[model samples]
Target: MKRVLFLFLLIGFISKAQVKPTIQKDDIVRIETTLASDKMEGRQIFTTGVDSASAFIEKEFSKVGLTYYKGLKNYRQEFVVRNASANNVIGILPGKSKPNEYVVFSSHYDHLGKEENGKDKVYNGANDDASGTTAVIALANYFKELNNNERTIIFVCFTGEEEGGFGSKFFSESINPDDVIAMFNIEMIGTESKWHKNSAYITGFEKSNFGTILQNNLKGSKFRFYEDPYLEENLFYRSDNATLAAYGVPAHTISTSKMDSEPNYHQLSDEVSTLDFDNMTEIIKAIAISSESIVNGKDTPTRVQKIR
Candidate 1:
């Protein structure tokens, strides 16, 4: 009875800013191309290429007018691993009505580096995460333009995901998970999902009501969200969201990568040419629209069972 009442009220409070915030496919292309370019050396951690990626992300955050996270001087949140340095780029758009609550959007920027002597030396991870990282930037731009969120929105591009979830682990430890209302950890949305275009799946969908709330908010749109179908692969435990999920936060990954049949899963062939920018743009729009209630502090998702 309480659940039904909450849904009814949530549906009633649909965003007054019905005009979709601008999220251009062209902008996505520009960022994706730059990140996947051969010059970035596939953005491997501890490489000059990784440093370049971090700088690029910081520039985009600045362009979007995002303020620094937690009073940091810049977006580069530095941390070390095995005596080598890797940094996550984070930007913030503080909320007005509910400043204490937090909503996070994130993706990993690290990937496998180039082959030493191969003809196609670069492992351009366009679809693997450039697409996801692009979505993070695009979303940040969108929300900042809207400028009406009630819960603080954080945008972060994590490093060392390929090496293991090093960046996310460091970040999760730095923040109190209880303050984080929800986390949207995007990955691999460049290709068509198993459900095809205009659709994406959420990892750890059943762990909390996050997916349900998202789907409910998207009811009027053509886009749809499905549960992660590759249960045997244990995808929920993989990627950047795992650490926070263990902390009982409602953190989930959104993706369209088909586990068994992804042709470019980890190949050097994961270039920008393979992505469908139109479809990717729609997915970003869907997320922005669906998350309106949460961002504005109108909806609160249940916590994940804390992993001990």
Candidate 2:
């Protein structure tokens, strides 16, 4: 009788293990459309554009069925930045087992507000950060559908990253920091990489073991993970992840920006029409795949030790 029950449990485990993970094409399209849409006014911090973007993100999170942060009624984690009130859109997918241990995925949704030349002032920051924001939204959809994570997953869409990283800073201060185990901040992944095709780099690669673990997970996949070639760019400590990493978490920024030669980067021509959808799709999938182990509590990357 005992042997019969054991065999039944074993069969159930095998069946679950065979399930294949997938990302939706519609979700990808939504990302591009949301980023390219003119209603966002480039998602500038403290502006109506940012407010509209936040509403859109909250709606997406609601559709995914992700819960709000504890004790909060809505998805917005409101806070003040430099005397101006802003917020970080927050949602959580509670873990099946370890609810306290968290893995955070973040992207700053705010961008350069407007440009000088009156008529040419609308800065459609498609690649600067809209791409990253899209990636975060898409990732939330993918994971929520799977609904099998062992560690809690927190999706944060931050504001004020362009001004001074205030949104992330405010969030980092509000949290215990110890509950967070890892953080992956997606940034500007709309273009092809330099060295490896269909590959992306992790900023501050040498600071922690997270990058190495991510690469190992992608061994059989078409995408590859590489250390950022533009280390002099100081990208690691420049993004939203820097705040959490300072607290000794395994936090890093994932990006595909060619710092030295991105012709449209931060320019008027930085539009959705210029993005490579194929590469962007692959990048999102790669991130979803690489993070599976971490989300499942199977592989916990080492905590980052700050240089300064």
Off by over 4 Å in 2: 1-21, 116-119, 306-308
Span of ten consecutive residues with least summed lDDT in model 1:
12-21
lDDT of 1 by residue, 1-308 (tens): 99999988887777543665699989999999999899899999999998999999999999999998885799999999989988999999999999989999999999998999978999999998999999999999999889899999999999999999899999998899999999999999999999999999999999999999999999988999999999999999898999999999999999999998999999999998899999999999999998999999999999999985
Candidate with best TM-score: 1
What is the C-alpha local distance difference test score of each model?
A: 0.94, 0.87
For residues 1-308, write the lDDT of model 2, one tens digit per residue.
99999999999999878456577656776776786567788788999998988999999889888899876899999987668889999999999899999999999998887765676676788887888888888888889878789999999989999999989998898887778989999998888888646899999889889999899999988889999999888988899999999988889999999999999887777888888888888899999989999999999998888543
Q: Cα deviation of 57 in candidate 1 (Å)?
A: 0.4
Off by over 4 Å in 1: 1-20
